[model samples]
Target: MAPSFGIMTAPSQVDYADVLRVWREADTVPEIEHAWLFDHLMPIFGDPAGPTYEGWTLLSALAAHTRRLRLGVMVTSNRFRPPALLAKIATTVDIVSGGRLDFGIGVGSRPSHPLARREYDAHGLPFHDAAYAVAGLAEACTLIRRLWTEDEPFDFHGTQHRLTGAFGSPKPVQRPHPPILIGGRSSATLRVAAEHADIWNIPGGDIDDVTRRSALLDRYCKDIGRDPANLTRSIHLPVSYDRPGDTRAAIREAIDAGFRHLVLGLPAPYPADVARWTADELIGPSA
Candidate 1:
């Protein structure tokens, strides 16, 4: 199958108008199937003082503005918000987008990434160890799904989270909740994705490494009695305006590696007509 293509506009170092403009244009282009924003409370690249918008918040605004594109945060940090609250926020976005929402989530940024780590300190959010974060993410997926699908209010107690009388009202526009896309390359995360995610996404760069990770994910899925084929393979490839050929080559490699869902990451200070340019220069040629 031809891989589905999407664009990811990181909500940092760019004005809302800039992101909106690209999304609106992408909406009209049939070639662009979805759009995304990164989940970051602060800038992860360029200047640390640069403006950065909240992912879900900006996603809601973009969801309301665009008519056709399926939109979401590429992967929300599970640590940033309570599972129940995140479920509600995701439900709201799904409703706002008229069911055109893909719920992407992950265990959050690794503490080793200095730029991403500072956001936790600035926000007064606790930074747990890898084990705790991965375990919490697993628990979160279970709790959020129940909230989205259960008919009655229920309580949940887990290793990382505790909820009393938790229930999602005005459930998401997508029946049985939006498609869950879990992103990460760790084995632990791949285990979580095997059990919970409808799609699994990873950053693109080293095709060999990503291919190995995909094979690992297949093993994880099989171990859990789930068919690995049921989970869609997605990859995020950075777009290069000066080197469109490089981007196309990466796309082709990802597709050949069994990734059928492609998200092209556009750097900030976006060029005018970027979405169309993506379709014409990158996605079109790759296709």
Candidate 2:
């Protein structure tokens, strides 16, 4: 598959509907298997006041608009929704998208606005601790997967969640469950991905940095005696092509280094620069 490439439409200051249209057009681009959209309440990188779209709402719209192209939240915050509710949401999205849903979830990064009990600074809540957060995420994943895959009534008891005699109806279209993707580069994150994630999405970093982090994940998977092949390695890269043929070389370079997915963040202004960048750097003949 030559390392499938996709676009991560960072809704930072861009028009959501317009980006959705571009993504829908990308379905005809032949090389794109998935079109990833980030789930964040605020801009983590750019100016804080910039416009940012809510992730799931955007994805739900994308599900309605896109066909053939897989749709996903690059990584959603497990802290934002109850595990049982999230399970149903993923299942619903999968059914609606005809099995094209990929659920990428993570512990919330930075304290969420109108913050609740799960964030770093909320009173009476534990601060950001890797061990505790990983445990919580593992519990959530276990519960969510059981809710989706188990036939008989299921009960889950863990450090963070407990469920009894509850079941989710209309199981996801994907057998067993929709693919679970965990995003992060920390050791705990790697361990979680090795244990529970079908895909690991790392932040954009240099090849050597990515390789090193990936080796850590591979080692963790090996220690657990889980075949690394079962885990997919994906990277989110910020790419721009000012001239013809620039992005292709970078694409080839990433593929050579074992990146299975490359998500290029198109610059803002939905109809102008983003469209041109998508055509030239993402889906163009040179790309």
Candidate 3:
């Protein structure tokens, strides 16, 4: 089978128009399966109020323009939107795309990043303890999945979210909902992915790093009686436009290391020549 590939339109300073251009161009390529965005209310770096369009809204708009491409965030910050509403939005996007949706999500607010904390502070969102974050993510995974698949309304009670007779209507177009890609590298994260995710997404790393982490995820899968083979492994690769060969090498290596899906990142305002090269050299043959 051909390798599945996707792109992350750099979520920084680029205007939404250029992003729409990229997404439209990328969707026409058979090699490109999906386009991803980051869930951030504020800029990840530089100015906090940078020109970052909302991820969900962007996907919603992109859905109207594209034909075959799937839409998703690299991993939505679960705290950025409430669980049930998030599920509703995702289902709507899936419907719009005619089942072309890959629903990726993760907990919000990284402890190591002060900017994330600052973003949360500015928005009055809590940066909770690690335990709370992990447990909440697990519960969220369960709730969202249920919301997408359940026929009857159900009450849900969890440490971070509670719903009474939650009636998530218009179930997703994909059976049992779209594939959920769980993100993060910590042990808690791996465990949650093993239990709930159809795909496991981690930041791109060297061959040895991918090997080591793949083994770790396998262990987590077995501990819970889930087969590791059932989970699709993906890497988020940050590529430099000047280093095309480096991008190809990393992608080839990741493919050799058993990663089936790639989340690719290009520089903002991707140059025309570079984008063409990405399509011809990197993505075309892989597909």
Shift in Å, residue 87, candidate 3 = 0.9
Which candidate ranks first by lDDT, i.e. highest?
1
Tens digit of lDDT per residue, candidate 3, span 80-152?
A: 7788899999999999889988999987768788677777777887778887888888998999999988899
**What TM-score quantifies how close candidate 2 is to the native fold?**
0.87
Task: Pick the winner on TM-score between candidates 1 and 2.
Answer: 1
For each candidate in turn, the TM-score is: 0.99, 0.87, 0.95
Query: Which is the winner by lDDT between candidate 1 and candidate 3?
Result: 1
Query: What is the C-alpha local distance difference test score of each model?
Result: 0.93, 0.76, 0.84
Candidate ranking (lDDT, best to worst): 1, 3, 2
Error of 3 at 144 (Å): 0.7
Model 1 residue runs over 4 Å out of place are none
CA RMSD of all predictions: 0.7, 3.5, 1.6
lDDT of 2 at 64: 82
- What tens-digit string does per-residue lDDT give for candidate 1 at 1-287? 67899999999999999999999999999999999999999999988999999999999999999999999898999989988899999999999999999999999999889799999999999999999999999999999999999999898879878888898899998887899999999999999999999999999988999999999999999998999999999999999999999999999899889999999999978998888899999988887
